[model samples]
Target: MMEDFSGLALPPLFGGHILETELDAAGVELTAGTTEILESGGTPQDIQKDTRELDKRKYQALSKRVKELEQVNERMLARLHRVQRLTRRLKKERRFLMKTLDTYGDDYRNAEITIPLEDEGGANLDGIPGGDDGGSSPSTTNQPACGPKKKRHRVPKEKERDAQ
Candidate 1:
């Protein structure tokens, strides 16, 4: 009976070969040849495993970077909030200072230095020589001696008086 090799997917039966399985040097040579083929086939699988390992490393690095960016974003948000609060406080202080300057009009100087607004008697000075205690200063020499004027409200005349 002729054996159908095409239908048999298995390797040739090792027992059917009359050749010696172990012929010293010849056996070693055949085994070495088979091992070389198997080693070549293993290369593609190794390359695939290496590619997967590289991809996993890249993903871990990107994840670590994202976490660092999130931490930076959180710190920036906190700083922005603190700056907003400080800005609000500075604005309130500026308004209060402006109101104070308006109340002390005429006695306020445009200089960038802080000068006392009151004397020993707690009276506002008008920067004039002989104006308060008769002491003369350079700022008082060219300016007139004028105290801050009290704001006044004029009441409307009565309707009967206007008619008359």
Candidate 2:
């Protein structure tokens, strides 16, 4: 039996040798590829550099956006203050007008006297002592109504004669 097995080339045992050679070849290819990457300043360092650059750009963009938002916030606050001031002024004016209306309401109502439009003879003036007829009565006394009476200036007889 042993002599027969030695003469017969037993088919490759489960193809193990072929699989080992393939694995070795794959490992060599992987090593060469890694070496090439290492010669070009290594993958990790390149990735770190790229990450740093991206972070810098993002920070700049975010800072710029923050500045813009702050400016907008300031403008909005200014507008809000202006609106509040206007509202306060309007409220003060409204209160002042309301007080004025209250103060004058009674006087306005009392002073209003309506007369009939159909009175062609004009309003009756009998209640007042003075008549509607346009004339003034001569004063009974010599004293002025408003102030002290004025004295007449009399020229001397000699000056009057000389002037004549």
Candidate 3:
């Protein structure tokens, strides 16, 4: 395009512009020159530039990873809830077993059942079997019918020494 450089006014800051032109493949000539006065809308090419490439595999992998992580989190939560339930069940079973043992002790104390064995003096000890031997008395394993209040043993009484 042949630009008429005669009518163009150069701003005072840039002094003046020297016009130059070149022809394109379509025989349409293009002008090249630096102008001091700035225009409202400059070149259309200056608006934007594209540098994008498509990659579907990268997006698919990211989505798959997110889904897998979510599934793992769900499984962990379920396992934690199951563990809590099992722990509660175990504690309940333990308490029930202790209560059963206490009931057994009560039944024995009331003489609901009898076991046969001789005492230290060849006497038959009541309730449970396997009492102390005649020569050396065995340690007592019988729980008191009334049971202990504080559940602790006091120190044994000291034996007195005989003076000559």
Best by lDDT: 1
Q: List the residue pairs that clash in candidate 1.
A: 130-134
* TM-score of candidate 1 to 2 decimals: 0.39
Better of 2 and 3 by TM-score: 2
lDDT of 3 by residue, 1-164 (tens): 54555543322212332111111232222221112112325454442211011123334444654576578678889989999999999999988887897877755335565655444465645544675344433334565567677757765555533321
Backbone clashes in each candidate structure, one number apiece?
Answer: 1, 0, 1
Clashing pairs in 2: none
TM-score for candidate 2, please give it.
Answer: 0.39
lDDT string, candidate 2, 1-164, tens digits? 22333432233322423322333433423244445555777579785665565446545554654576578678889989999999999999988887897887745435668775423344434456543444324562344768866799886798789998
Looking at candidate 3, what is the lDDT of residue 122?
52
lDDT-best of 2 and 3: 2
Residue 132 Cα positional deviation in candidate 2, in Å, after optimal superposition: 58
Q: Which portions of model 2 miss their true places by more than 4 Å?
A: 1-42, 106-164
Cα TM-score per model: 0.39, 0.39, 0.31
Full-model lDDT for every candidate: 0.59, 0.56, 0.47
